[model samples]
Target: MNAPSPFSDMLFEKREEQAILTDLAYANGWMLDVDGCLVKTTKAGGAGGHAIGGAAKLLDWLRRNERKFVICTNASQRTVATYASHLRSIGLDIADHEMMTAATAAGETIARAHPGGRILVVGDEGMLEAIRSAGLEVTPPDASNADAVVVGAADTYSSANLNAACLSIADHGAPLYTSVSSPWFHGGVKRSIAVSSAIAQAIASVTGVQPIVCGKPSRELGESLRLRLSGGNSQIVIVGDAAPAEMRLARGMGAMGVLVLSGATQADELSGLPVDQQPHWVVQDIDELADQLQRVIP
Candidate 1:
């Protein structure tokens, strides 16, 4: 039913190719890996999180082996603690410390760039807490002394709030930062627009100050993850379904890209990608990927 994979000559069947490619991913030594959002959340989409196939097994194995990996995601609706707890409830053995989120990245970035500065955040309660936890002061939208604007996932947006952000950036000369660049996300039954991007764009249009993104595909998050890794020239592998987030992260970090079909991306989409943008390996899901890793690992 499917055309032979372009990698067939060197690796044979899909299963074999998956194993070989995963092996190659770790060939340089240890691997510093990050997963896409859908790897933990349901592909069908919904308000909460669920473990996908082999998610628990793969994460457990990695933890038991003390492998270097993190579940990096663009979902900023909840705090990292909430997501970690949700994953654990779904049988995935993940800890809060093992997760990297866009909200957290945004907070850290803002703190690094301007410590103790006043940040006006247009996001959920979770995002607000994350920024506060990072040691930056959170200011209300109407605050006149705001030093920066950080946008994250919000359920609602009002023109008044947007105007405040614009004023902060344009009139006050404050910088703008966004949690993620994605325009939308899978909402279980359908794709829903990402309010963060909308808010960011609205303010950017008015202020003409493009946002500094602090999520996946941005080197800010990648640099944070790199800090957690054991010092070495170890190769990294970014596994995800979203091409723009995970694949772009791989290319930026000089890491291998692995695309799983159990999420937002479909098989047909692979053929249309440019060679440089294409993932190094395409598999059914994380289960298949874990299987391949098990076969090659000593």
Candidate 2:
């Protein structure tokens, strides 16, 4: 398929980079993003969300091929097992160890920063579990004292919780960590704000401390990916729609960053941006991308 713009044209022309990715997937492995890139937000024309599409087939093929593969997501509300269960429930068919999420990455990063740290976490049971796996304890603000504040998607966020988190961070000189800070994404007709970014902004405004984000473009997720792949950064490929986060991550870890036009970033969004802001290959979606890869890899 032809690229939508000249910026995309330049991105595709870098055959040297493309060769490396094709070689990597053909030889070692590939990493994929779940939302938008693989799963559609809504059922189309009577098909449910669980409908097994081309992307799911690709995932199956990866498993069959026995090449290293992992699902790297910025969604912090779920544990790795929960993410895998959702995939299986939705008919995607993936293993628990095959998933790596920002929630897990953030917990790991915070654990390293403050050893045996007390964490004031805002999220579901999954977030709590991920933190605990990394050797950290979690608590609600008023019930207990904590050494740091960890924010993500939560059903219990409010003015009181925000104020309490800020106070904890301020009093203990604890570092603040957030799983993600993305603004919004399209869903049906309306747009929804990412919970992590909203909570991070609120706490920063009140406490005057910028929370350290450990997902998406951050190295924490990269580290998790590194472990799951076990093939090092040179053989991994990061695919996504957002340039700012995924692209920065690819560059930082010497991985191939492939972007598709199936989600948040429209084709025209790449105009006048530097080369670093573009993907290694711009395609329509995972289906077309898989077809393209067949030609390049073989």
Candidate 3:
């Protein structure tokens, strides 16, 4: 037999679900912040690709109603244009500007910290391009004069890259930056430690300088979104699967958090979390949440 859900008092009950969702719809607007909450990849860690489900329908409905929403994600493996193309391939029809990514956020953060300055990036081609797109000069990791070090997703990391980053921070006194701080993420079938996190950890160990994260759960991303969605009186709603990252992001932004079981987090994990860390709503998936929204938002 399964144990009772601690959220039983707040969720699934008909009246309470209606009441909460109603208030959510009435808010200034909603932000469907994480990709994992809406789409699932075919392979572990999105190595394969993505597929859309009920979340696509939800997006269409929101668009038809002229509602304000953004599909924000922390996956910084590619540029926003590439991610948008990937979504289009899956028939989701998302525009590049409609999405916010950790890559873009990292770029924006770096630009603000050291505008037009050279940055040593330790990541993949996508991360390098993102930094460049942010209007900052990209220096090779070995560049001794790099003003900062920005770390992101990188499948190929070497000792040489690590050494360059260390030298940049310790010797050059360059600040260290990262896309996301979470050590691990839910790839479709299993959890994997983020390449950026691993590299950041190694650099911090050597230089004794912690990285400033610019992705989810960091105020940087939230502040970026706040600027993007200015002149809004609606409340913000963050829906995602990861607890440590997405839930913390919602808390940091003072937005409503909805957890779906289709991604990283499982129902059993909720019991172990602190009361404050718990999501305000829990559902089986985006489809179920959409159903709830349809019933209450009209």
Best lDDT among the predictions, by candidate number: 3
Total clashing residue pairs per candidate?
A: 2, 0, 5
lDDT per residue as tens, model 1, 169-204: 888899999987788765223466777888788788
Better of 1 and 3 by lDDT: 3
Tens-digit per-residue lDDT, 152-177, candidate 3: 88778777777888898999999999
**TM-score for all models, in order of appearance:** 0.85, 0.84, 0.88
User: Which predicted model would earn the best TM-score?
Assistant: 3
Candidates sorted by lDDT, best first: 3, 1, 2
Native-structure RMSD, model 2: 5.5
Q: Regarding TM-score, does 1 or 3 come out ahead?
A: 3
Instruction: Give the Cα lDDT of each candidate.
Output: 0.71, 0.71, 0.77
- Select the stronger candidate by lDDT from 2 and 3: 3
Clashing pairs in 2: none
lDDT of 1 at 172: 87
lDDT of 2: 0.71
